[model samples]
Target: MPEKNVPTSPPTCPTDLSLIDSTYPVGVPLTATYRLGFAFKTINLRLPVILTKIIDQLSRDKNEIGESCGQEARDDVKIVVGALAKFKNEMVTNKPIYKTGCKIWDSYLEHIAQLYFEGVVEDVKWYFAPWLHVECYFYKRIHDAFQLSNHLKSFDPFRKQKEDGFECSKKSSAQLAEYVLSSDSSDAVLQTLLEVGLWGNRCDLSLSSGEEVSQLGNLVDQLQGLRNFVLCDESANFWKILKDAKTANPDNPLTVGYVLDNAGFELFTDFCLADKLMDRVDRIDFYVKTTPWFISDALKTDFDWLIERMCSGDCSDFPVLVKLAERWKGYVLSKRWTVVESEFWTYPHAYFEMQDADPELYSTLTKHTHLIFKGDLNYRKLIGDVSWKPDTPFKDALRGFCPAPLLSLRTLKADCIAGLRAGLAEEIESKSQDWLVSGEYGIMQHAQ
Candidate 1:
């Protein structure tokens, strides 16, 4: 078991959300006029366009796919293409989520059935469902389309974009890699690395409508410019947790775990940080998305692909990257670094719901010194995607979901937030009309 170094921060301002009131920015019934509404609409509509592009490319290059998987993959390609088009059309037309016998089908269906049993007439409608449920079902439905196919059960439509996104950020990766190795005080370097890890979140494909945005200019120098933008700064607390882990395990290095977010560039940045963490910890356990979820989320395959890319790809000009790649191979060989996949992550449920929904996963979470949740969706899950008043305490919103002392490193790409000081959210809103979705601001909150 990991030694506890939990912070003792009181709830910022305890605000109860259990009371029911159907209205926008306060409580239930998130409507079409809000940014959440528009963001969901844009993502749902944009995915089909992406799926078609993948299908077309696959159809044109069936021979290429066959060279690796087998000729039967051509038929699987056709199955996947047809299924993706059908799924896209269903969402575009507001068709009810269909049953596909997935593991979550019973729970999801029962939720809607119960909603209908109660008097919620718009029980299963896409826009009418809980924003979290709607979003969760959308990605699962996409995965189902591929899963029901023959040879393409594991095929990832978003794989190309993820790979391309990483390729595009090579310059940023190299700069951060070099900076990490530069001789500097341990505290300053750790602080810089944490901020770089935070900013790496700005490039999420889900927020950018499937586009790639690389980190720009000198990452270390850019930290001061981003300082004021971080609504909640807990980088120091996180470092303390890491240091405490080292203290606890004086004879052996502690293990750190990451509930990973986006793949490609963001994951490369995570690796840059993980590479540093490895020097102190016995290992780092990366919990990746079980499937190609939310488009650019890291899958087990993505982790494997990145290792291969670093080891064999022609981008050999980066000495830091190459050195890390070689070190990563040895770490893998020595069984010091490990990867895990859990369907619970890809499930539509919130973090608070995890202990009940998947106790096995929640039980596994307890082994880590700390679990670091990356990116916006995980943040949304942490807070249950509730419309809590801007100053609601982070732990208060957590609703007792803390499995271990944890940290959330997220850029504010969505409206749901908690743990800000009084008036901070309003102040941010007054200064910038769209602070939440602009990716200009961030949060590095810690909770015990």
Candidate 2:
């Protein structure tokens, strides 16, 4: 287990917690505008109930594990669930959410209130619903605790800033020449490269003038060399497998599935991958959450207010353009990919159990489909988002789960690193303490 970096300061309460507690709960039923306030209250109350179910399951399974497993899992869940129950009770009783550093707590609570008033309660709730609200809600509470105690010095789980200086430096002129001369399939490669580049550019953390267009141009140039290696005799073997699958089962369409993440650029990347797979396969099915609170760009569902705002020229800045491109990409991809929205992924059940419960969903997912899970949150879900050691093997971490030919493409945005090569963790530790959580490095893993 990872050691907790606790602070040695007394706890304090935020001044605005009272304001937030009173106004938020009352506003739920009294608001005359949108029903968002009521939605937020409903979701918040439901969180504790969901968490109670998870806690019950953990207790039942504790006796079946080893001494260490039983002790650790039970202890961790007890502390976490206990903290959640205390927090919820405090809220119900109109107590301050934070004991110290009240200003920051107030600011965050105000932000939550504004988001609710602005009709983003559904997005906020869905984002927190995973793992019965244990992960995100715990993080939010931790943030509040640290801020109140003035313990920012000790809390360093997330990197202070995104690592943004990486550039592809090498060139393969000879390979590029051979690829151009030998293949009639260059167009597919070029198009795939364009889509990935555009998606990356649009979603980039840093904003720029014509960033998407500029990145698209540079990506086309950079990928030409990479494409050559991927298309070589030895590498083309994989393509042959895909081709054979397509040829032998013409009646059974090849399905490409995307387990989605955040909206905008992230969704664009899913589209790029979907388009590439669609070029080779017969069909594509994109899965999304079915609840109003669970909808995201990944589902290609409409956010009517946001679309209307954009259309009314409310968002005209370069950064806004990048966001607009993200929504537009989803709109464009929905035309080709068969979109399936479900509540299973949002539930607390294990993947195989979810599959067992919904055989049709699993059958559709497992048959002829190459599943692509995107971003940090999805990666967490894929691995159960536990506190595995940094050097744990990917296969070991994923022991209980298997869902088609899967590839997890993610920039490291949180704790819980695994599948490291020998000495890779040591090398990273020697150079930077924050490397694992920095979102600097990425992974391309295929667990079949």
Give the alpha-carbon lDDT of every model: 0.74, 0.42
**Alpha carbon deviation, residue 281, candidate 1 (Å):** 2.4
Model 2 ranges off by over 4 Å: 1-133, 136-241, 247-251, 291-297, 302-336, 350-353, 356-360
Deviation of model 2 at 276, angstroms: 3.1
lDDT of 2: 0.42
| Candidate 2 lDDT, 1-448, residue by residue in tens | 0011212222122223312322122112121112233222322443334334334543554444225344444345445445546665653333322422344334434444454535333333331222223333333563343333222213221111110111110112112223333334444663453334222422322111011211223333554444321201122333445667778987766766766653433443444444445557666666764432221223334222223333344334323333443544455456544567775655433353445546777777777457666655566656655555655776666755665766665655445546766677677668766554444455555566
Using TM-score as the measure, the top candidate is 1
Flag clash pairs in model 1.
Answer: none
Q: If scored against the real structure, what TM-score would every candidate get?
A: 0.88, 0.48
Q: What is the lDDT of residue 360 in candidate 1?
A: 95
Candidate 1, run of 10 with poorest lDDT: 1-10
| Candidate 1 structure quality by residue, lDDT tens digits, 6-93 | 1222312113212223235674433232433433444345445555555677778778778878888876777777877787667655
Clash count list over all predictions: 0, 7
